[model samples]
Target: MPTSKDLCNKEACDIQSCLKKNGFIPERCRKVIEALERCCEKCSYNSKHCGSMSRLLGRKDEL
Candidate 1:
């Protein structure tokens, strides 16, 4: 099974893409993105280089 962090990253990315394509407010998206960033920072599997990409994915409720 995929780790929770992996799942979070996938979900976040999907949400971010949807928000961007749908033209959602940047501020709102940023809020969730920030949360996603935090989650990525704490993830052992997260890559430093990919943190920005992880943030772009968007945030989800804590696992």
Candidate 2:
């Protein structure tokens, strides 16, 4: 049986591409990150692509 694709992969890749184009200044990628966050929220944070979201959102302290 095949597994279903994880959610938010495109959003995550968009964030990476945005950050690269913006000299790794995450602030410039805020919108893409927010998009991924919204997708992750919809999936209840179960996506593998969401594994780094806490750190990306600067909420690692809560982890």
Query: Which candidate number has the best lDDT?
Result: 2
Per-residue accuracy of model 1 over 1-63 as CA lDDT, tens digit each:
765545456646654675777687555566556555566666643644244554344333331
Quote model 2's TM-score: 0.78
Compose the digit string of candidate 2's lDDT tens values, residues 22-55: 9987777777878888888888888788886657
Candidate 2: give its CA RMSD in angstroms: 4.2
Clashes of each: 2, 0
Can you give the lDDT of residue 38 in candidate 1? 62
Report the alpha-carbon TM-score of model 1 versus the true structure: 0.43
**Residue 7: error of model 2 in Å?**
0.9
- What clash pairs does model 2 have? none
Best by TM-score: 2
TM per model? 0.43, 0.78
Alpha-carbon local distance difference test for all models: 0.54, 0.74
